[model samples]
Target: EAAIGIDDSFYRVGGDSISAIRLLVLCREAGFELRISDLNNTSTIRSQAARALSDDVISAPGTTTQYAPFDSFDEETVQRLKDNVVPGIGLSWDSISDVAPATPLQRGLISETLRSDGGDAYVTWKITSFGSDMDAERLRRSLVQLVGSRSIMRTRFALDPILGVVQVVLKEQVGEELVPAVEYCTSASEVKARATAVSQDQRWGRPQTSPLHIQIISAQGEATSMVWFSHHALHDGWSFSVMEQEWRQLYDADGEKPISTIGVDVPFTNVSRYLAGRDNEDDLNFWKTYLADAEPVRLASGSTSGPPPPDANAQKTITHTTKCDLSSVARACAVPPSTVFLFALATALGLFADSDDISFGLILSGRTLPVDDIARVIGPCINTAICRVRLQQTQSAATALQQLQADLDEINERG
Candidate 1:
């Protein structure tokens, strides 16, 4: 939708910092890589669209004639492989042992696990390009290589009984069960439905074990479809897309491991450790003061003019979209498009609540500081900040937007 106009600026059309990151991910999924800054510099639609198209052409997946099959591992072999351990990849108990505390995010997941029912939070990717030469065994090997190479892919959470802490441990290698691939000769729709069902079924599996799976589907009597599923805790949208591209590269590599230039100076584990040590007093105070008296605009209350519906929970939402000149609005208001949208949302909420003050949580990309190769790190990298907007009944739109921008700027600075 943001690529329609050749002269349009991404920021001017409501693209914020997070949006820039998402655009880069989209480019990566389209078989290309683009820096967030590149999108910022080349804000015009023509430039970005052209670069994306060209990159897709250059990075197109190549056809393969020979590969491994799906039934490469037997029960005994897979069990032995999982029993093996890496020397220095997990918790240590030496005199100089450095204890790695769980980050707040991981702790949150731990709390969820204590609950009776945890949600299925995972991502799935369906692949259609499959040649007859590409067998399950070959795909299994590529997946094994992928898991061994990426730290996040190999990570698992283990509770340290002595320390009373759940520390992340990297397995030496994943077993066949972890990376199982089976042939399913079915239609595309059936394959997708089955894959989704399987992915959701394993959402609550132990994190100490590999939370990834691959299902091979042969559509139209040809073995040409595959589905990849992984737990969301292992990575975000960006990291997942990168992993997808890397898997493709490994599959295409002719009996050789692809050279990995996507170096990570600061791994996800460091970020977790840093967050554990970093002080959040100021952020806490900001949120406390910000939301002290702010009330959420409740859309449902005792204001019904007709009979109650058959099932209140069976509600459906309809979205209407139209192309508006957002660039013009940005220029007129002297604020970014994101701010414009935020102000509009706040205004709508104010009307809904019959008040002019509102507060809500705005999720932000967690990488505020410049961590080397942070973008490439595969893990949960999102944080939520308090967004409080107070507008007068007679306040102009531009004025309200400016005030909102100021509030966000202060929060960013504090964070």
Candidate 2:
């Protein structure tokens, strides 16, 4: 056994969940039975190396992949993916006076929409036999403590005419009691199946209002929980997926206190600062031209009613899902899933609008902070951009894809 360099400080070399899976596969190929949790416990490269050496596990060198860090152009792409985050001005609010004084992050969330329709945001989980050694109260306390310590689970709002300022409010537990709901197995297959179903249902049934709600219900004697959130406005699909992942991690930790460094370092407040510093004249001009002389299409088929008024507060929604094997498409295009998804969405929106004048909003991950160490903070880290696709007489999907890639390249380059 050889002694490898062991650094006292832990550092993550930018490996996400997918990368962690790849690492696990590589370790297995090298005859080492390593799990994803192993990577979490040994976050630093040096630490992981030491673990492999200590176990006398001769593993092959893992392939390294570098990801582009967050930046302005990437910010624009993220804004396009999100539904809110208008340019130049802060969230377009109907009545700021009626809005209660909220934390900066909460204000940003509320201001994006017109009205505040307080709704329920609760999630549920079922615990099978609380492992003869498991204490229900201890688990509950651990969950509460985890929620209190994490800002992503907290509420963020703004106050007064303070354009860029934000305030954050931690969410409190409304009730704590393990109730019987449904029974499921504790096997990995069963747990993942249940979690995926819950995730899908929540994704499809998501609402569009404010005062975000989350609920978790655990069935008696079942190690599964049904988790649900009130609306999609407070958080996007990706956000919910992330929350589920972290919750599972915490649960597996068995009420053991988590490391303080596991918390999110970059809050959405920095996004506000980024927007405030930029001259949004171009973004405003793009939107002005995009919406000019355009009318909102009636959402449902066979509706005779005209489009709703153009008030910022007026509520409107259109849901359309494009059926395509995204993973296969990404492989063919040699681009990340995000790039492919955004391109398809942008193209579909442009085609549906019946004009080249189309602009969509997206959310960005703003982790480039001088003081922040982790980049997983919640709040609205999003930006907006116009994906102007000129329709030709006979445009093929390949051509559209090429054009989309070029547009993304330009947007990213400029950012």
Candidate 3:
């Protein structure tokens, strides 16, 4: 939950830089556009709201701008994608919207899924139940309208022989491409079996499928439930929140009617292109030098730091779980509970690895690009950057926490 007050601290109330972006989206959806800069300056609701745009000024620039095709791929291969590959993937050429280069994380994930056959680590599932008043046809049409309007929903990844990985967009997918047939189940066993099928669906790992899938089921004397599971590429939590608001409003407005009039935001391709523009030698060189001296972490006892040495796999079993509140310690150390855990983890790793120097990756929300509603525009906006730390083996815990926080501040500032 977020802190609610005129002078409340965002971090003190469980907010961080990353989640602040998600907060920005939530605030904007409520008819006031929140600016990230204002939140960074003063994380109080009164101050931020004073700076936020009112509903009158906040315009929904429905995504109608036709983006210029990204020209990074070979023209011939692109033509082949338009001519042959598209039809093979069950898309009509008329519905082809925009073809663009895959985001770095998209490429990494698509390649990984190909390497590890049928890997679905990023698949996320969510279910919503509706009462007996649920209009299945109205909901289905609303879904079609939603999918047709968003570029991310239409995205599908393809591997090129020479042009590398690219994302193909379909203008619209109607009917069963998204909203499949409703299943009627009268017993609990049938619902359990359906849930299992959703979990094991073959499309989760396949790049050719739409990034999103939906299913609605009705049970006797029970509320109708709609299942939404997507590869992370389409529906990151922030994106889903915004979409859910729109979907619910659409469902509530019309009954047994097609939802043709749809609202939109900035297209995902615009953000992708903006991000690609920043893919330069300077950032690459910065990270290369930042982690140049670091080696992969190896736990003295734990296997999570890295792949266990060739001999460590399947060697033993160690299972332990302990939970303790760190609020008091965090206060004493003048740092958040998260930082306290970071310090504690590093100390344990230092003792286990017997090394003074340690390095680990710090994940960035990857929404730093200067695009309109960048915080709200979501499509695989996750990045892993490394943080290296040298332990002062004899230092006090408070001193270590302060130093670590300073180092992290420097990373957040410069990186």
Best by TM-score: 3
Which parts of model 3 have CA positions greater than 4 angstroms off? 1-15, 18-80, 84-88, 118-135, 173-176, 186-192, 203-205, 255-263, 301-337, 393-403, 406-415
RMSD of each: 11.8, 16.0, 6.9
Models 1 onward score TM values of 0.64, 0.44, 0.70
The deviation in Å at residue 313 for candidate 2 is 34
Positional deviation of residue 403's Cα in model 2 after best superposition, in angstroms? 2.7
lDDT of each: 0.57, 0.42, 0.64
Candidate 2 to native Cα RMSD, angstroms: 16.0
Inter-residue clash pairs, candidate 1: 68-137, 68-138, 69-136, 69-137, 69-138, 70-136, 70-137
Please provide, for model 2 over 224-331, each residue's C-alpha lDDT reduced to its tens digit, 9 standing for 90 to 100.
344443333344444455555665566677555555424533443344444445576785665576456654432243234588556746676989875887655653
Q: In model 1, where do residues sit more than 4 Å from their true spots?
A: 1-15, 19-99, 118-138, 160-165, 175-177, 181-204, 215-221, 224-227, 259-266, 302-323, 331-334, 412-415
- Ranking of models by lDDT: 3, 1, 2
User: What is the lDDT, from 0 to 100, of the residue 383 in candidate 3?
Assistant: 63
Model 3 weakest 10-residue run by lDDT: 57-66
Cα lDDT of candidate 3 equals 0.64
lDDT comparing candidate 1 with the true structure: 0.57
Clashes of each: 7, 44, 0
- Comparing 1 with 3 on lDDT, the higher-scoring candidate is 3
